[model samples]
Target chain A: MAEKPKVGCARPTGGLVGQPEARQEQQTSQPTKEVRTMIQVGKPAPDFAAPAYHKGEFTSVKLSDHLGKWVVLCFYPGDFTFV
Target chain B: MSVDSVFVHKMWNDHELSKMVKGGVPFPMLSDGGGKVGTAYGVYDEGAGVENRGRFIIDPDGVIQAFEVLTPPVGRHVSETLRQIQAYQLVRKSKGTEATPSGWKPGKMTLKPGPELVGRVWEVWKTSMEAD
Candidate 1:
């Protein structure tokens, strides 16, 4: 018998070495209605650091580090799902 | 970027999108497993449990110059994005002196920023556009 995966909290636990279910649990929360405030343009982009899979490895990337260069922050849905 | 973890990103790259891109994607695909970035960007689609395909262009000064948030099932145009970035770069280099016109590209005419060009831009740009 196999154990069920644990749910992840609000932050990443670091690195790429984690169970699929636990890792995915973070983004799979059920949607609810709330007043949504839009992040306005012409303002400083919100900073973030996350484990990014680039080239052939998973490295931590931060938005502040690219301060002196152009940055394109794109967000898509989960991988392996139909777009 | 995908909402999956780095581990899942690796798996998807190694097994899926990598095959199409040959050596693999050239840019960093950040993982937003916790949806914080998406929430901050206001692109998180809570009902669908996924980010709503957001693309933001940030300047070197870290200010967002342009952005687009599209629903899933609509693919983005890489060429248009490239053109936009180039336009932004051109404008930044001009230091508020020039503005990129429609369908503007490198070597294309840029309108000078002044009160004179406001109402009379068509007279100057019409010939250049007809030549193209």
Candidate 2:
């Protein structure tokens, strides 16, 4: 007869094993009253302003500034990564 | 949007992107450091400290008309984005009277949606028309 396997001692410990305390603390610290809104079609886009590199010059870009014309916000992982 | 800084964007454009496209990209390469904009757009990955690939097409009224998000491994096509933009523009210009079928391009046939077209789409539109 094969030896009995260790019961409950061979539990897989791949994910969420050591990080639960930090995660729970983070959740408890934040206010539950705040609502998170998801980005949806047919809804007004959340406006933003940030530094940008355009045509060999450094400038700022604001979403609301391009109100009169159509805007395409193309996002990628990073500058050097394949897009 | 991404977590890369403006300096990195400039270097990448100067060294790499310029060879791919003339004068690099025509639009601004925003440096969304700390993922503020990405968080707002729901593309920020908290564990990775970066944003996933995403695109948003905002109409003239500042409302988001369409959006696409993908993982880092897959690449996006500029031609497809342009085609979608053109299709959206045509529909907007027509004031909801016209609708472009799948894979519709400019100069292709468009369907006039109405009560008459409710069930007769097969009669007026064909898959072959998408090539036109």
Candidate 3:
């Protein structure tokens, strides 16, 4: 079967080029007891995280890191911004 | 929306999202409650906890348009999203003649560039960067 790069975790995320899920498995667990609002068009954007692109490369970027600053957590589900 | 959220990927501490932040992505990408953003955009599958691909055009007024959620495993295009922005911008500048065609780069062919195209927009998209 052709392996496609999975955008999120907990699945095969079969793309051969993706950062192996085994890597992130070492730290942190799932968040619970919170709605973790995914879509907020008008309200203040929620705080959440994922290893993100920083300085022209992927690094550990957390929302708490930007506490007191402005940030736009524009989330996508797949490769290269959707398409 | 004074504050906006745009998530192109999700890999907390993984190489991708980390690269984005380190690479000067200029934004933070929150988790979607196991794809909650997709769910909010009506694109997440309750069983899979992933998302469908779609363009959610939210006006600064906080109204949603073109909020079309996509199907399983498909992807979206940045250029297409840019086209939406282009379309919004054109409409704001006045009724122009540019529809922001496919692969429409900025400053490219916009409605053949001619007169008599009053109130006839070709590439007018909306975005938050617009002036009030």
Candidate 4:
């Protein structure tokens, strides 16, 4: 019977730990920053009023206006994107 | 929400979304110009001048019960969002006494949250329960 490998005993030495090239890769991989706000579950959602296009008419929408109903705010990158 | 202007939103709804969904989305398509609202929601990408794909489920009390942010390459599902809203409504109707299990749907069995349920959830719930 083969001995089982010990957990947390295998550490890569020359592999992407502290290399300058690895650091550059980390910086380049930084995508959008999504941690700017303190939004959290069970907390009050940030309120905002903005211009909206609804049902062939231009109008304005306020977050506070939908207080007594369930609101689903769907945000996307752009309008025409296929995603 | 996005940094796109309201004109663009209207054009897109008229030209594209109308063909996809009937009546071109029954809800408001807000134009978060300059990513202001997106910034407040933390979904704004300053470099791209657009908001990332995000969704927030706000209850009647204005509390954010759930949220999700995804990269632009991924699309969100309306069915999943609807399911979550129903689940949240059930939980709220029960006043937090009932908790929905994983893959729970409307009219499915829910778990009663209490000290007695601790460590014995496995006995009460099974993965097979997810199938209708």
Instruction: Provide the RMSD of all predictions against the true structure, rounded to 1 decimal.
Output: 7.6, 14.7, 13.5, 16.8
Stretch of 10 with least lDDT, candidate 4 chain A: A10-19
Return the lDDT, model 1, position B112.
96
Model 2 regions more than 4 Å off: A1-36, B130-132
In candidate 3, what are the lDDT values of residues A1-83, reduced to their tens digit?
A: 11222335342111112223434533654422123344445443333334333233333343344544333223345444424
The window of 10 residues in a row where model 4 chain B has the poorest summed lDDT is B31-40
The parts of candidate 1 lying over 4 Å away from their true place are A1-38, B127-132
Error of 1 at B104 (Å): 1.2
> Chain A of candidate 1: what's the TM-score?
0.54
Clashing residue pairs in all predictions, respectively, total 1, 1, 58, 0
Clash pairs, candidate 1, are A74-B1
Fnat, model by model in order, equals 0.76, 0.72, 0.14, 0.76
lDDT (C-alpha, whole model) for all candidates: 0.72, 0.74, 0.41, 0.76
Candidate 1 lDDT over residue span B2-115, tens digit each: 577767777887898888888877887677765656766788776676888899999998899999988888878878788899999989998979898876877888899787
Highest-scoring model, DockQ: 1
Mind sharing the TM-score for model 2? 0.81
For model 2, the docking class works out as: acceptable
Q: Compared with the true structure, what per-residue lDDT tens digits does model 4 show for residues B53-105? A: 89999999999999999989988888999999999999999999999999999
Weakest lDDT window of 10 consecutive positions for candidate 3 chain B: B1-10
